[model samples]
Target: MKSLMQDVPLTLDVVLRRCLETGVGVEVVSATPAGTVRTTWGEIGRRATALTGVLDGLGVPAGGRVATFAWNTHRHVELFLGVPCAGRVVHGVNVRLTDDEILYQLRNAGDEVLFVDASLTDRLAELADRLPVRAVVVLDDGAPVNPVFADAPRYDALVEAVRETELVPRAKPDDAAWICYTSGTTGMPKGVVSSHLACVVHSLSSMTVDSHAVSREDVLLTVTPLFHVNAWGLAYTSALANAKLVLPGRDASGAHLAELIEAEHVTVGAAVPTVWVDLVGQPHRMDSMRRVLCGGAPATRSLLDAIARRGWAFHKGWGMTEMLPSGTMQVQPPDLDLDSPAGAITRVGKPSAGVRVRLVGPDGQVLPWDGRTTGELETSGPWVIRAYLDPDDDSNDTRFHDGWLRTGDLAVIHPDATVEIVDRVKDVIKSGGEWISSLALEQALAAHPGVAEVAVVAIPDDKWGERPAAAVVAADGLAPCAEELVKFLAERVPRWWLPERIVQVDALPLTTIGKPDKKALRARLSSPSRS
Candidate 1:
């Protein structure tokens, strides 16, 4: 069925190859606690091509999965381009996953070639028995390779052996480039395999839409892990665009990130809402940052306001693991009132340049776009995942209808096609036969100056099927009190819609992937009932 999409092979591999030849003068920066490392495009090309030789020497099959259990360093960044372009799958393993979970994924991915950063070698060595890895490569050269694994290799030595190589074999557009796993909150994590074509489009649209909207001269901060959607597709677009890409290593804490942003003169960046909370409110210098593309969860209205007050724009984003983890973005529409109330910035905004959206009811009927009728939001387009990769082998065909994929997210579409996500379809709070959105209440509480964190969830109520509860973090100069927050909410929502109870906590229980762990919160608050 080769529909003749493009015989020229419009893949990510091809893009990087062209960049080395045409954009060799571009700057690529990687920042670590050790210090900042700088490399030009030619070096990137040489390193990546040489790494291909290392993979070939290791007997890595063309379609074999090469796994990386490492931090966000330039060396890690090299593998981001090299493995896939070399006609192999790069599985950027989530280091945050539990030990048992990590073993489960390696087995599920059947990954044979392992790349371990020196920082992770001690921990990774312990799991060598559990993985089918034929070879283990370490990123840190000075550190002795943990002898727990017999086949482990050093990353730099492998590259040095192939430094004289000029070119690496390229992958076709449809060849699998990388593998990203989705949090299996209900069970085990499933793989989301992306092809070179889908990835190329994802990165191109991302750079055009956001990615610091970086120009040739801009420098970027990739505090977001390179393991996540190729660090939210920033490296892909930035290479060809001639921007300098900065990696903050794995230290994403406020102090470390603030230091890197200032020292590197980072002009653009992306991170979750919490990563910036401490940085934005800290007593450090951040004059170089121009904008932050935030995702993994909604950035509170107050957080956005605080960053805006500092003069750098805050761009909000919403996506799932399936959309190459990119779906919609908010960039302050041309007519949006800069002085508009906090309500304006919370919405998910418009479809990305390469995606489509539809609001559908339980019956699968597409609803009109008026911003009132809410329904399960479904989307399908280039770069959108057709179905998740299941180790147990579930039917992926069912995940797609016609050509569209059911995103399992709910939203209301405005006349302008901008979307306001209410909550996950399963997360809506049901009370007295009416459904209320948990997202709305959280956004309301977030607007209050004295609230630093908030999570809205359903709790059991005998009178009503389910009631809403709010867990909050007290702001500076404010005591942690539930009653006052309830009163604050009353002014925003109808009395019936207000959270029935409030609990104060220092922080919300964020998932390993950085999203709110609503399911875990609900279990913690209430016991399972047979009713």
Candidate 2:
């Protein structure tokens, strides 16, 4: 009964070689500190081969960790190929982490070779002595003089001096390929290790019609940082599809991204909803864009309509670091009437193939997908992490049950498998023994013409256990009153969900990754000046 089929190993080298073979002429453009640089996939492949030789010369052991603290530039892309293809784990450290967090990740990962950006030399030099790194490779045109890393080598010297030859050894599919840490919003950051097979499957699964819909003809302008969740897995998908990549290094501002999208003729762009908010009202020509992939937070109805007016579709995705960053994507059925005002704010769509999703109640019972019973969302898939890196770390115990990851996201699943995220488990407002969704309230407020940004948090109330309060940031050229906003919400949502107080502020506090820092807002509301 055995059917014979040729067995092939799924590793990073498979895609790296495929890119060179099929996409040798595709352009990889990047805006670097020096200036705009352009290179072909063939040239990058050759350079990456040379870099692999350099890493070998540096005595990088097989399965050793090589860390990169850089932006999404062409050089970083090379590290994406060189390190993993050379059988070394690519540990991408988030550059925006706090000084102490940066130190902790570098030391905890036990990274051997530190490949840092030139701009971060001073920061790395401060903690280079404490890390287990044996060599420092500055990823720049020339090595800068620093007493702490004076002996470090420059990226250009090492690559150019080495011979152009493939040094990749045969690797197993289960070999560790990359490591990226969580945002550490609550506790110390935890590492998520992705194997070669996991990433290969994720990359292939992501480009399907229901997911990102990537192809060779698509030009992707990735606004997400490479250090965070594999830049939403754009790196691997682009290579797999032989698509053109445009990297906007360091400067992800509205104006800069607008210019790059136009200049590069970017057809598809991916970033969080906050970035889209910044670009929506700004003067930018986004006519070339066909679709925008938004994640990290849900997109408001206003934002979606604004993008639709420009003839571009807006998509919402829901995921975390543990799921290889892609769990669900927004896809409306043809029968659904999305043109209606009520249907404008779309839900996070069904899970992709090979992923199983369910909602569980507080009593450990599975909730039905009836679109009414709200519960904690849990997911399990080939790409999802079954456990954290540390064997004895029980701090995240409540985060997992059996083998599924407890997403800590409060959501309702429809009969069609589509999910509408109501709130985070910690951010949901509990008032009078009824649950109030802060995200739902925020979405309603954001639809107001004058309300530009809004974040709702639960504040202490004597009558109810807690009441919802809003931190409003007005839109440009318009100032809205609290009474008008309250009336606006009264028409849309239940009167009980309306905020008792609305505090106008210049801007909402944002996390390092540009998410609304609700934790800080809660602390501020507890203070006397705000209370």
Q: Give the candidate number with the greatest lDDT.
A: 2
Q: Over the stretch 375-479, how does candidate 2's per-residue lDDT look in tens digits? A: 999999989988777666674586798788999999989998988788899888999999898988998898898887889999888889999989988888887
Q: TM-score for each prediction?
A: 0.93, 0.94
Clashing pairs in 2: none
Q: What is the TM-score of candidate 2? A: 0.94
lDDT of 1 by residue, 1-531 (tens): 658565566777666675678657776666554556777766787788787788889999888899999888778878888888878889998998888888888877878888987667778766667677777877872345566743557788889888466665668888888888887765567788898999888877876744336567678787778777778877877776767777777678888888878887888778888888878887777888878778888777667777877777667788877888778887753234544632365587788888899988888788999979988888988888777777345637645666787776788889988888878777789899998988888888888878888888899999998999877877777764777777888899989998777877778898877778888888866665311
Window of ten residues with lowest summed lDDT in model 1: 333-342
